[model samples]
Target: MSTERRAPLDRKRVADTALKLLNDVGLDGLSLRAIARELDVKAPALYWHFKDKQALLDEMATEMYRRMVAGTALDPGDTWQERLRKSSHGLRGELRGYRDGAKVFSGSRFTGIEHAEQMEDTLRLFTAAGFTLAQAVRATATTYLYTLGFVTEEQGVEPLPDERREGYDVAERARRMSDFPLAARAGAEIFADYDRHFEEGLELVLAGIAVRFGGS
Candidate 1:
């Protein structure tokens, strides 16, 4: 560590350092002490700005959301379905951008005003599509929960090396379960084309929403 003097620390500074440390060590390995050391400050000094590690993580989540939405430009003329699709795809991209991004977003208890306002905007879109306020909230929640769940699973998969992948026995299992017609045929394509898979799933969810409240 250099002996260079540092500027006074604030919540954003601490959270920014924590975010970098998160990239280096991942969500499981990130700790308050690690962030403090990364900032060249003592662990106790962090408490002045954040009550604890959770508070730091909340800020990190807020920053992550801020960055994710910074470049998003929603068109006023977009149909509600189009807007929702755009929002879902944009969110997925953001969650996959950083190491353990999904984990950090899911773990934090984000309470920022911006996040609340964003939620309100999404709900308004649903209501504008003809759903009641309660339905709008449920619709927005259902869409995002699906997005979060899908991305979490996507990120959890550790890609096998090309050589190692060839040794996997997925096809063999499908053959052994030949008695089950659907499983046998689908097994070969189970993990292929995730982007297509996610889109298809989203369409199913949106279709349900459309049927339930499209013109209500």
Candidate 2:
């Protein structure tokens, strides 16, 4: 019997394959050996392209960010606040696309040229809106961190179990929180639409920036 041979390996191919596997095994279950097996190559072969798992993960993150940034649209007519709002929403949508996507992307040290370019563009948005260079940098970093942190927790939330599904109803939640007046009062607001929550939180941050920087 003849043995099947695989194509030559490269960093991109490895990273792409790893991402597909990520959808299946998640970040914690992913391993170099598993990636190699998926490629039908020896595990040691991957080391030639990546020094270690972290290196591979970083490449994966770079690619993910690269694509996300590429897909983002910047409208010239939009005000800085509007631009920031659009960018924030774009980022949230991108991060929520994959399982553990935010966690994996956040774990990376974005040292690639694309990442540098993206950072530069983000800073430009703030600087153009009357912020000093330092302020722009901080604002950009703060927004990025906020989006990442929010999505990380968003994806981390477990779904309601079959047995507990019925108990999670609105009436049941209201009843449970009845004894706790404050929680009961805030229950509806707390469980409001997540999309709206993200939008409102982003607006608050942008509003603070506008107040401090004097942008329209």
Candidate 3:
């Protein structure tokens, strides 16, 4: 087939290859050139499909969102808390599924949507819980941020070697936890049983929203 007749690399093709590259190399090492190289094409060729790295990252985030949205219902059948919790876990799992996926989805204005497709999903949950459109927007933002922050940490994000090591299972971590009463008492609860911690956090955010809104 002629170069003109070459099948276009649609968004999925680009994202799939990018995802592999992400798994192969973390975000800092990722680039349009890397993706193009993986796909056996020139770096400029990627511009035909993605304007830039941010655009490609946005597409990748959208791919993860699509997967998350599929697991959580959009038909408004559950409690807002349930909906929100489901979205939170769905998103966390999506990010955990790919390499450097958490970094890609967390803390960036990929397309500067501050609110994206997942934001709509979150807003729908709020409105279902008896929130007005404005209230839904405001309230959902908090829960969304909380969810993203939780997931980012769940991916084992480190603030500092000494600071972040609290979650690590090293001997130094044990010695430090032993010295602090509260940290010692809560150590197992904090570092252990992530499932319980995530659920507890999910409940706290939901309850906060409820008390401020109506579900209490």
Candidate 4:
């Protein structure tokens, strides 16, 4: 036998592979065998580190949080508002890097310490703005819910197929779209640029928070 030591299987490599697989086949199509094939290893090799698929996915989510922290400063000099905006946009940009990454990383239970720190940063923001920890947590939760919900939808959009392209039946969709002028006119123009919407949502959150806590 050759006396060469194998490079230890790592969480980063595994997460990177999973993200690659996500871009290739999406959530429903991703699998251990696929990841193993991508890594040039047998399926059993992955088991040495992750135990099971869900465990691996959980680690991916954790890694996603760590990635957000790595990409952001959460700085001391920046006001809490600046911190929150940077953190959220950092995560949004990260999710934008791979297909359906937002869908994979969103929701509860899989979040690690880094994820908590995001909320803690938001808490610090609200606290600095003069709210208690409980209030800060609650306010941060609202912003987080909106952010995750928005990102998930955005990530899910690209994978949409011909069959799923709004059904192509304007008359059929008209009843559902009747009340919403914006949704009804969601042609290329509406989606080709999302810069305005992202800023608008962020502004709405900050404005709402300021109104609630600014007077104090």
After superposition, which runs of candidate 2 have C-alpha atoms over 4 Å from their true positions? 1-7, 158-178, 184-192
- Tens-place lDDT per residue, model 2, 50-156, is 99888998998887877787888776566777777777777787767666788888868864687676567667766777788888777766777888888776665
Q: Candidates' lDDT values, in order?
A: 0.76, 0.75, 0.70, 0.69
How high is each candidate's TM-score? 0.82, 0.83, 0.78, 0.77
Tens digits of per-residue lDDT, candidate 1, 173-203, equal 6778889979877855654555887899999
Better of 3 and 4 by lDDT: 3
Candidate 1: which stretches are off by over 4 Å?
Answer: 1-7, 158-189
10 residues in a row with least lDDT, candidate 1: 158-167
Colliding pairs, model 2: none
After superposition, which runs of candidate 3 have C-alpha atoms over 4 Å from their true positions? 1-7, 107-125, 157-167
Per-residue lDDT for 143 in model 1?
A: 85
| Range of the 10 consecutive residues with the lowest summed lDDT in candidate 2 | 158-167
Question: What is the alpha-carbon lDDT of model 3 when measured against the actual structure?
Answer: 0.70
